[model samples]
Target: MIEFVFHTDDVARVRFAFSPLWELVRGLRVLADPSRHALHLPWVHAVRPKLRGLDVGFLRSAVPATDYIPDFLTPPPGTPLPDFAAELEIVRATPPEVVAEELRLTERGGAAGAARRAMAAEPARTLEAVCVQLGRFWSAAVEPYWERIRDLLEGDVLRRTRALAANGAEGVFADLHPAVRWHGGTLFVDRRWDYRGELAGRGLLLVPSVFVWPQVSVMVPPYQPMLSYPPYGVATLWESSPAAPPDALAALIGRRRAELLLALGSPASTTELSRRLNVTPGAISQHLGVLRACGLVTGHRLGRRVLYTRTRAGDALAESPSVQ
Candidate 1:
């Protein structure tokens, strides 16, 4: 069990941010044991062939099926919305000593041990090499789908922020995960090892990750007190095809529009919707404009993008069995 005691100020300071680096690192874990992370099998199947000849051996070893991943590889995001380039630079600048120490703490046996030792012996060189591989891996596996992933993450943050406003931290943590518990003035995370610490006013950083589903990760002091949990709706992240709408409704609204309405079951951006439905962005925009004008959809500006979702009337129309 890991306990983080929080003070009044600590509660106020609690903030949420998502990181590309964290996703990339945790993603390696998924690749290492795809069976354990069945939710990500689609991603695994798509990414494996792209990774051919990419030198991610050390990265794979560092993030074994079940073991301690080096902290230096994944520092807490400096900002709420950090790009991959910035995060990669942070990894590139990690002190050689910190890299070596963290790598030494990972599993030490067989190929894993050998990889760790080699990296530990040449931390600076290893850092550069790792950064290069990470860039290639990100382009191949994550960048292609980042828009969809970011939309889900942003929606999650919006939901949690609303929960925080309405019900305080308890509301956000109450249903965060089965292994997480929040009570009194402390946050508890169930883990194989035992640990306890106080926030001491440093506050807590909440990060929602798409790859860390079915499990939660924590970073205690000596680092920012950060928790990365799977965001809501991750189960649907890799779904390539949207469900077909009822034929009757499709006839009422053009088939494409009906499909678009049904796809708005969750908030999504134009780009994300376009990719998911294989429709051009211009067509999506035109359809969304019509939906917005008709009161069937609403759009909210989040960061640089606008996320659209079904309004109450829209939901009713989509769920109406008698639309015929």
Candidate 2:
């Protein structure tokens, strides 16, 4: 079990952020063993062919089958939403000593160990190679679907932040995951090892990831205290196409608008809607304007993005038996 003791100030400091780098690192695990990460099989099938010519041997070795992933590869995001380039720079700048220490810890007796040893021997050189490979991997595999993935992650943060505001930390922790628990002033994470750390008023960073499903990862001292868990609705992330809206609703709102409403079952941004529906952002904005005017949808500003969701009336219409 891992426990993080929080003070009153720490509670107020708890914040949420999105990490593209985290997704890329965790994605490597999913790609390494598609069978264990069945939810991402659709992604694996699509990405494997793209990665055929890329040499990810060092990258693959860094993420062993065990839970220990080299910390240098995934530094917690410093901002709420950092692009891949910003995060990659952080990785590129990791101190050589830190790299050697982490690699040493990752070392074990096997093929993976040999890779780790080689990396430890020349930290700076190996780190650059890892970064280069990561850049290529991201372009081919993650960047293509980032819009959809970011939408899901953003929606999750919005939901959880609201929960935190309405019901405090307890509310957010209630359904976070089976392995996580909160009691009094301490947060507990069930893990193979035991550890205790204090927030020390730095609070904690809550990161929602698309690929860390069915498992939650925690970071401790020498790094920002953070937790990465699968965001809600990740299971449906790779669906080839959206479900068709009810025929009656489609006829009433026009098929395009109805499809937009159905997609808003969870909050989403204009960019997300555009990408998911294969519609232009301009078209999506026009339709959203109509939906808003009709009292069928509402938008809320979360950071730089405004997320749209169905209003109560819109929910009724979407769920009405007559519409089905």
Which candidate should be chosen as best, given TM-score against the real structure? 2
| Local lDDT at 114 for model 2 | 73
- Deviation from native of the Cα of residue 234 in model 2, angstroms: 1.2
- Per-model lDDT: 0.86, 0.87
Distance from true position, residue 233, model 1, in Å?
1.0
lDDT per residue (tens digit) for residues 1-324 in model 2: 999998877878899998999999889999887777899999999998999878866688777655478888888787766789989999999999999878878334233367788888899998998999999999999999888888888888887888899888897888999999999989999987778989996779999998888899898875789988888778768866578998999999999999999888878889888877999999999999999999999998866888898888999999999998
Q: Model 1: which residue pairs collide?
A: none
Regions more than 4 Å wrong, model 1: 107-112, 246-258, 294-296, 311-324
Pairs clashing in candidate 2?
none
- N/CA/C clash count, model 2: 0
lDDT minimum window of 10 residues, candidate 2: 106-115
lDDT of 2 at 79: 73
Instruction: Judge candidate 2 against the unseen true structure and give its global Cα lDDT, from 0 to 1.
Output: 0.87
For residue 112, give model 1's deviation from the true position in Å: 7.9
lDDT of 2 at 54: 83
lDDT of 1 by residue, 1-324 (tens): 999998877778889999888888888889988888999999999888988888767678666668788888888886766799988988899999988888778434324477778778888888888889899989988898788888998878877887788888798899999999999988999987777988887889999999888799988887899999999778879988788888988988888999999888777899989988999999999999999999999988976888888888999999897863
